[model samples]
Target: MQASEVDYLIIGAGSAGSVLAGRLSEDPGTQVTLIEAGPADRSVLIHCPAGLALMAKSRQLNWGFETVPQPGLNGRRGYQPRGKVLGGSSSINAMIYMRGHRADYDAWAAEGNAGWSYEEVLPYFKRSEHNERGADAFHGTGGPLNVMDLRSPNPFGPRFVEAAKEAGFAANPDFNGAEQEGVGLYQVTHKNGERCSAAKAYLTPNLGRPNLQVRTGALVTRIVLEGRRAVGVELLEGGQTVTLRARREVLLCAGAFQSPQLLMLSGIGPADELRRHGIAVRHELPGVGAHLHDHPDVVLVYDLPGATDLFGLSLAGAARVWRGIGEWRRQRSGMLTTNFAEAGGFIKSDAAEPIPDLQLHFVIGKLVDHGRKTVFGHGFSCHVCVLRPRSRGSLRLASADPRAAPLIDPAFLQDPDDLRRMVLGFKQMRDILNRPALARFGGRELPASASARSDAEIETFIRNHADTIYHPVGTCRMGTGALDVVDTTLRVRGIEGLRVVDASVMPSVVGGNTNAPVIMIAEKAADLIRAQA
Candidate 1:
């Protein structure tokens, strides 16, 4: 395609981009082009549920970005594996379908972002989902995104829930149900036991439409701006610089880190920062990459000697998985259907908290260093994260080149209260894992957790191990404040024909998994853009 006129040219065919392209192209009059930096999402490791462990260590399907050394993390760099495929992180991530707490969106409205309250946005959430358990007032049927219960979860998941009950937490069947205050197995974003990523749900189904064009291996260099308005984009594809003009809009759906990086590279960020990088400034948006944050999580690993149900590295474990693969291929159910973080919950760090301050994920395998490191033997791990962290960080330009990674500083555990909450949440996890119900399944705690006894010891342990649970948001925050980057309409405040409709525009990070919320955001954004047309 030459320098063509695209009615809506969307950057990054990830979670939000896929939704926008699919929805905006519904009208035959509207021509949409969705560009993705990564290749196609055809790898079997992506579709298989249990393949997440191997995907985590391999950079084949991900950006494999890492942070600058974080002071709060005891001067250790944290791993950030963003999906470099059509589905974005949703393709490579654990397929847990979570929509976070309702109060998270309500809080966005409280901060002057209208149409973002829980009540206002619930319809979009409902519209984007087709839950396997059937739809009700809170859920909708016949949607693009497929939400379902895991095909065949390990038995250890139920045991963890039982342990939670024994530890005094209630057993809530659905975390995304009426109330999110108990422990249970998680429903996944899967269809027929295969991963149903955002791209698969929204993009792939609509690819045959004449108005929609999907391009892969397209790296957007910068937004093509004339004076103060973004009219198109310049992308490096096929070893050539290609310019595609957007007749109506240039929608940016890049995730948290790259969205801001693109804006900064396009000369729409802080003036001094752009000038120092030797990039010409077109518009100065101070909050382009500010307010970066994620759910800082700590994992507690245990060495269960008599484990038979958990995934491990031994010969017996490989044999079990090998047999399970055949079962999954035949019946679409077995151990291979595990999402690893199969069971999870939402709970308060303290009883005085208004809503759940901490979220729990009980993995059926030992996850050390985001599963990048090899922890031999059979065991289970529990992850605890602060739902709402007070700490904030930023993403800045690492180099003038567009291909270079950004300077990601999540500033984890910077706030004293965040550390305090994490310490408290750690105790909660240890209690649940050591409960009488799980005593038969429990063994000696891992070395790092075992050494941490007092509150101070726990804090030290957290500082040494806490990293992102992969839910990063609030970089190009949406609001009306001085530092706000986008408005409630999802449009960049100072730029015309440009809008941001990804997790980056979130005013704050939601309390649970971010994939579902991002799909919901794009679902509403499509309506907002079309309403004006």
Candidate 2:
């Protein structure tokens, strides 16, 4: 498998790449090599489900990308923490196993992607999951990724649901069920209390296969092209430039940002923009890094006095975390098993809206600045975001050098409609947070959002604090339009041997958390590729 050439030379051993490698290598005759720019996913911080909080400040396994100054956030740069590890963002994400609303995918099919409607893609989602709840019309069993309720959920999570109920939202047991509306505790990508990331689900188990080879710390610099067709790639590994030939195809699964960067770096992007970066354009695809969008979320923090169940930086909290660590080591069950965003829901910005256009994530902590800035108290936070934002953004190269981080401009809140929905979404979430069910534990609202009384005040607060909930997609969009980078089968429109099989290929960001959908994309992609082979 380590030979100079492989049948599938997959770049980026993240969510999609892991699935692609695992599925493609199921054929004993096929050779697959999965490359990751980061080190191995062997960190205790990575395996321990609760370690993500500490990962916020550590660059050890994160591509800590900061957006260019955004005009909408009063020119403040947004923080974008992408996983640089094996499972990609799924390894560092909140681990909520959410499949967006059905209509979201139906819309994709309607946009000319024939095989991407909800009913068409649902099987792939099921095929990739081993839901503890067992096989059903909407869920599957005996699959690589394990989906289950938290092993040791914080009691406050149920209270959050109750609070949402008091605010008039129904309690839904499964957000991925028939209806996406209503509050509930989220299912996580976990098995026996630990994370079941895409790597763990699809790649790690198959690493022993003679046909699958995984190389870590190998940063792919550029795709080696010949007459507009991808033949292989040139990468930097062990301080040496290495060229690996692809006998079949070169798959780009580097997620939204790097996927497009590698495409442009390889001389396939907007002609003029590539010229400015001194890259010779091999293809004039203007949509490589265009049509970028993500969920824009705002959080409200409130102190919860005398709450020992919540995570905090206090003395008592330290003692609890210490015990939780020991408990997790012995049984893989404890507070450590909890994904911080324990409870949430999909609700509408207004009744007139066709589907839920807003989503919520209630954390059993005061998640200040995505948990990078520590707040010293026992408290909880509730996040509400415009699920389908009108704002669009773009990612562009800052330099021709492959090592440089690209200029990311999410253009959050650039559309006035997104801002309007945020104001209304904020009011609805504030009402849920202030309901009687959540009042038993605590104190006043955090100063940042408490004083906002009028709609204008809420709008100001939203503009000041809102940023991505980490679902960025549509950079290498798939459609029949002129700007489409890939086609229905995810093949790059103008390239023969290159295809994007990550979140970047999503024509539109889905309605909820994106990890599950990304995995589904890779699952269906594996089938499409095999069908062709």
Candidate 3:
């Protein structure tokens, strides 16, 4: 096979990969190539904020992987959706621009990941953001990624916050500000009412740069390693195998599942596991896919009568949407501009906890089973999840073929403590939903949550209903421990010319939505790579 060469070979042109590709190619001396398994982010569903409401199940834009019957979830296979488009999940997520909590990063620093403390990493976050709120000590203004308040939030969003107030929580206008604990409307990564995915912000504008080459529909089969160092990647494009060598480094930004799956497929994981999968071990990194975890969430849905803000499939709803299209075309603001989870916040279930352990997502629609299960009529929903789950899982090779999906076992709610916490959080969500501020909407709870009042009943409801809130991380965790895959600098511990820069590198999942953190990681990784160069 003829081999092509570039200064940097980045696998997966998603959130992190997009940023890395754009940043590394800034220097004319650096040649960077980014490979994505999915197509370009050109579909309307990718750019429209309302498209996120249904984008979770779009096969063209989502890598719809299912878990192997989570034991913690009563033997039900949980749905795992990662972005298959150029922007990765950022293209399909509810654009909530959250950086998690400060304590989350400090804990990483405490875990031996120097320079990852909240204070150290804040600059990278500010550097990537162009908050519409203007420049401040906590925010930046001229950055690529546009962060703005919703121009057309559902009227129900404020009612959700009002309900929180009635339930005794303070109204916090900014969850990303001085504190995170309270009710508030979420800031979104949007520009002029359009989704501002990482690809749009970092990659699209730099497409003309001669130093950058982006390849879509490239399914990477394996990383080509010379002994313990990654040299390049072997990818299948249009049924043809191609080898692309990196003269400098091969970076993996394939997110949690694929990053470790690629590592294991390339013989860089546990010796025994690789052997079982009929692969020769080149390196025995036991933690390649060992620390997988995600937020375990449960949705409390309610039926709302005469709700014009929430999305629906009825004739009246469709008519309103049809009219909304014209309104959006004219003014760039309308119901079409809604990111359904418009308002949410962080809360501490226990006063003794140092930071908020629970998060709420107040959706403007009645979401069930990640919206996979269709619920008729007009309604709204609220999601409550454990911000930092104690349970961890694994991702392993199900087959030797790289084309095959990896065995994903998120092990949701495996820790009894997580279940206990979910029960507590569920009560808090119910209390807020029951407040008089929302009572006038005339909604009733679904059966699963309607009668579950006691702790035991709530626990049963949790085990049956809890699933992923879309954030899966830590499979290729960064730290100095024996099981750590990468060090503080994000370089593979036992390998050279390789580094993992994505959500997988997080030693622990942050306390909020992960897109912002993933971008921040790539921003920081770019600096680290340039400093060495």
Give the candidate number with the greatest TM-score: 2
Error of 2 at 445 (Å): 0.7
TM for every model, in the order presented, reads 0.99, 0.99, 0.98
CA RMSD for every model? 1.0, 0.7, 1.4
**Rank list by TM-score:** 2, 1, 3
Model 1 TM-score is: 0.99
lDDT per residue (tens digit) for residues 1-533 in model 1: 33378888999988999999889989998899999999998988888877888887766678999999999999999988898889898898888888889999999999999999999999998999999899998888899888998878788899999999998899888878789888999999999988999999999888888888888999999999998888999999999998999989999998999999999999999898899899999999999999999999999998887586898888888889889989988887899878999998998888999989999999988889999899889999999999899999999999889999999999998899999999999999999999877777557799888999999999999998999999999999999999999999999998999999899999999989999999999999999999988
Clashing pairs in 3: none
**Alpha-carbon lDDT, every model:** 0.91, 0.92, 0.91
lDDT of 3: 0.91
RMSD of 2: 0.7
Question: Candidate 2 — which pairs collide?
Answer: none
CA lDDT of 226 in candidate 3?
93
lDDT per residue as tens, model 3, 1-533:
12389889999988899999989999998899999999999998877788877786688899999999988988999999999989998988989999999999999999899999999999999999999988888888888899999998888889999999998889998887888899999999999988999999999999998888999999999999998788999999999999999999999999999999999999999898999989999999999999899999999999886686688767788889999888887888998888899998888787788889999999998898888877777888999999999999999989989989999998898889999888888998998998998988788998878988889888888888889998999989999989999998899988999999999999999999999999999999999999988
For this target, which candidate reaches the highest lDDT against the unseen true structure? Answer: 2
lDDT for model 1, please: 0.91
